[model samples]
Target: MPTPSEDGNASATAPTATKCDSEHTPQPQSVCEPDHRRSVVQNVVLIASVTLCMIVNTANLTGVSISLPTIGRDLHIVEDKLQWIMNAYSLSSGCLLLFFGRLADLYGRKRLFLCGCAWLGVFALGCGFAQNEITLDILRGIQGLGAAAAIPACLGILAHTFPPSTIRSIAFSTFAAGAPVGGALGNAVGGVLTQSTEKSWRSAFWFLAGMAAVCCVGGAFSIDKDEPYQLDDRRVDWLGAFLGTSGLILIVFALSDGSVAPDGWKTGYVIAILIIGVLIFALFVVWERYLERVQNGSGTRRRRWWTPPPLMNVSIWGRANGKLGVMLIIAFLQWCGFLSFSFWITLYYQNYAGLSPILTMVRLLPMNVTGFLCNVVVALVVGRVDLVILIVIGTTFTAVANLLFAVIDPAAPYWAFGFPATILAVFGADFVFAAGTLFVAKVCLPHEQSVGGALFNTLTQVGAAFGTAISTIVFNAGLTKASRKYGVEVHGSVANAPRPAQLVAYKDAMWAGFAFPLCGAILALLFLRGVGVVGHKTGPKVVDSDATTNEKTVSHPWPTLLLVYQAVEDR
Candidate 1:
């Protein structure tokens, strides 16, 4: 059916329409999203709003590192407790992201995005005023929930608003650039504030809070009004949400906390928690599978008063010629190397070499420069370059970066070793992140954009946790062996240990860390090797939730704009 649209064009009435032509013959109202609903200036603002928010989000992360020492001193917190200040934020954010992402797709992305900003503003304000260690840690954890709520929705809004074009590519690349720049500012701003006045570390939180407020207002004014999902499609998968959130929290907490515990992996509670989390995740998988089957009418129905859809369908793994699932694993693996290099680079400058905070930040400045440059390059080369080649480059760079850091010379010139490592690490991250994000957006069902974004982000976060934990284990083992050989306390009370042994420990960890990206690179080479012409179905399948019959199809990719490297040919 064709309807008379406001633009005096025949628009398809069915939601099956994926393409639009505001400049020509388009399908439906979704096509009218950016050009028809928003002006060019508004589009620019929309991109800027998401970009600035990304900067603020990452700034909050690295900024905390700047103030941690001062915060420890002012609050009389022990050294081990400082990890919580950072980990709490990551834990909460990682655990809740998927749930919030699903909500964004179901309800409204714009609404969720705005609320997240305001909520973040409120709690970030509280974090600044917190007087005690426990209070601050709690506030930081709760504050993380804001990011979980907003990130998926924010990404969803972009995917929804933009048609597949160079503009969307630039938007994502610009957004990627913000992360490293924000990280640099986090250190710079927190350093500036902490150095300015006594007990001024708290000012960092206030700065972030104000930034959140600004992002919220800017996004509200700039982003287009969201088109709503169907009433029947707006069901919440409550049971799946509970299982997913709890399982993720437990798993991440165990992985992260295990490295820091006194007994490390041998700790009884940590082991138990890890097992429990793994089991819960398994259960979540089964539950989702069942729900999806039921949703498709393959199973008995009317089991409950309301049958909500699966928060994430288990069959998502089988989509996109199974490249989606394989890439998820590759992305996770590559990020391990990426996160480790970023983490160890700062530690190398500070803990290993005893550089001051400001000096350490200066040493890492190349990362910001490279990240910005990498994003620009990504925007230019992305549809033109084979995606697998870009991923291979990214993984190889990270592996090399980690290896360089592992063998870094204390007396080496910064340009010879440190600078290259910093630049390579950011380049790797930006390449993978930008490409991976765009791929997920393209493959996902239009309604599942937020959930897809959440899935990608969540994997990267978990990868970071594993990277940290695995590196810590290696570092600890190296220190223990050194202590045994030297017959001293090299493994314990690092300040009391031989400095050489501690340096060896850090090197050992970094050496082990490089293996992750090496694995990623190999996998990328083997599986996601090159661009191929996208396969198409003989006929389009109607989007039906309750359809029971599973007709095998030649291909199943959603027919969105070929925003990436896939070539389109006239049939």
Candidate 2:
């Protein structure tokens, strides 16, 4: 935001005043990355590097999921505890995202990204060597901290590396493609490794470790360096950070582990923790609001030295004709359904159908294949088609995927229901991911891209965790009810349960997943009706939110930027 101080007008002071490499001549205070600083090759390599970061983190999550059953059996873990394998990762990553997102914006994205990669790799290796369930879960949770940092940084870099344009949209689509591709590959490769008695499922962690190390090296070499932060929002909101991060950790922990508690949700500890978490979260919001008001000059122009900017930039909601705000809410809802559906699909193939891990992988291959094609389609259509159509249709596909599987008979041929469901799942997930990330790149100011990326991912990742928790709760309840009907006992492990009860449990879980995305689509259809045409909003790096004298709103920038972009887009 303090543009000319670091990157701008030192060159202007020169007597000769030679023209810059950029098409536009250098202005005293404007900021522009010199075109000559990055070659076309550098840009491609940078994209590849950042995209690989997304792939590895996503694959790390999905790949470990397919191995959950295997890990449970080997580690003698119960069915209830097995979900922790996934929840722990999601919890750590989700809780820490906003903190690291802001950090990347202030300190540097490339720096945070590289550090995250190295941390992830080391811990992934630790996970490979873990001897028991507790050790593995602990390692996995720590590994997710790396993901929280790296993902936001990756998105932040993409936002700056390429400005808003059709080409940027395609680049974002490629980046978005990483999630489905990683999920698909994680399953295929995880299955191969899991089915083997030699490498076993632990090898999946090792594989992730190796890839993380590779990506770290590539990113360091490719990502462009950040300018000196001589002037920026360097103040850290220590109290807000503590409240926000700790509150989230407590809430997600309660949601994740509550179902398995001795007395379930009624347990005193669970009730206490949940209540405390909610109250603390409320306080965090109040604190952030107070800081925002002060910073925006509503209360005082000379803010206290202790005060700092809010963890999340509030104006992000108004970007893109207020579509960005709705999109984030939609992100949570759609993604809540996504990973849950994928997780159950794996179990449906292996646990229900009695197929080997490799065979399960084969059954799921169609989804990944479709996901690849869907990525390409989204890239092609995102700029050409109306975004509202793409979002609603894509979200609906995911809901349908869950519904189809919910009613399917395990004895039925794969082609009858499973084939279409898997394919539909990919299309739904990929489309939403590409469109969502592209909007972020276009909507967020250059300085706030990391926080924007973090906000989007915070919803999506936390939604995944919440979805898993809900499915697990519904699943356990269904198993108990159906087991009673079938005159059987459902234990901590489903392996010993009756076939009828297990089948009913899977369907119940799938139904929960179905409801989530359906809600997302309805929300989109209703609120997004007034959304402006999806296009890039280009402007200065930093604009004050609310100006004094009440003449201009300086505290929010997107409101004005939206008008500017809409005017240009209309023409």
Listed per candidate, the RMSD to the true structure in angstroms reads 6.3, 6.2
**Candidate 2 structure quality by residue, lDDT tens digits, 1-571:** 2122221112222221112222333322112233446677777777787777788887887788888777877899877677778878887888778888667756777899899998889998999888898998898889999998888777656655554455455566567677767877888888888888586987988888888888788887777776424333578788887898678767867876677788878988988898999989888888887876676666445578888887875666766557678889888888889888987887777777878888888888887778888866764566567667888898999999999989998778889899889888866577776677656645554434556667787888888887888888888888878888867766445866888888899999999999998998888888777443344323222222211111111111112222222222322
Tell me model 2's lDDT, rounded to 2 decimals.
0.72
Looking at model 1, which ten-residue stretch has the lowest summed lDDT?
551-560
TM-score per candidate, chains pooled: 0.83, 0.85
Deviating ranges (above 4 Å) for candidate 1 = 1-31, 34-44, 69-81, 130-133, 159-173, 259-264, 299-303, 441-450, 490-493, 530-571
- Candidates in order have lDDT scores of 0.69, 0.72
CA shift of 100, model 1, Å:
1.7
Candidate 1 lDDT (Cα, whole model)? 0.69
